[model samples]
Target: MIENIHFIAVALLIALGIYTLIFKRNLIKIAMGISILASGINLFLISLGYRAQGIAPIFTNAAIAASEVQAKMVLPAPQALTLTSIVISLAVTALMLSFAIIIYQKTGSLDATKSRRLKG
Candidate 1:
């Protein structure tokens, strides 16, 4: 059903990310691949909290109605965690990109093999 589709999507994203990271020689491409992998994991986590017949997690003090009972089925924790992860991932991506830019400026190349800082 829907679960199988989600699994396939997540698996494909992870596979592409791994391929990009391993096959791309450019640092920026590798960073982008890592970001893709992180995003896929985040999506999988959010999907895990989804219920086909559920509703939002809002509540009121009024007497519970049949509709309210039917609407009180969401899991907020996973959504919150995903939001936090997105913010953290943004920061990490910015930092990594900045470092890559610095490396490129210093060495004038995007290829990791051309960087001489590691040479003895």
Candidate 2:
């Protein structure tokens, strides 16, 4: 049940991001939309490894002995992957924004169609 909800939310986020990226003319908005799409993908991947009633992956002596841990524990790999992806996305977004700002300064406009330095 909860998984379905998460899937739907992620889907909507990706869809909106793509729409913004494709339809928006401003370079900054397109970069922001790409970031949104990356975030949605990260969320979706993280949700895949979620266990309903599981505890954290910390291995305490008491927790180990108590046997309260569920057999269906969430996988750590997906979480780590998501974190790495988010960091990479942040770096990419910053780079894109910096470039966009530079372009705007040089072109005096945010619209991508206005910046044509390579046109022959």
Backbone clash numbers for all candidates listed:
0, 0
Candidate 1 structure lDDT: 0.84
Per-residue lDDT of candidate 2, residues 1-120 (tens digit): 754998998999999999999999899999999999998999899888787876667765434544555573456889999999999999999999999989988878999877756787
lDDT for each residue of candidate 1 in 7-109, tens digit (9 for 90 to 100): 7888888888999899988889989998999888888888888887676776655346766675556878999999999999899899989999999898889
TM-score of 2: 0.87
Each model's TM-score, in the order given? 0.85, 0.87
TM-score between candidate 1 and the true structure:
0.85
Residue 110, model 2: lDDT of 91
Superposition error at 10 for model 1 (Å): 0.8
The true-versus-predicted C-alpha distance at residue 53 of model 2, in Å, is 0.7
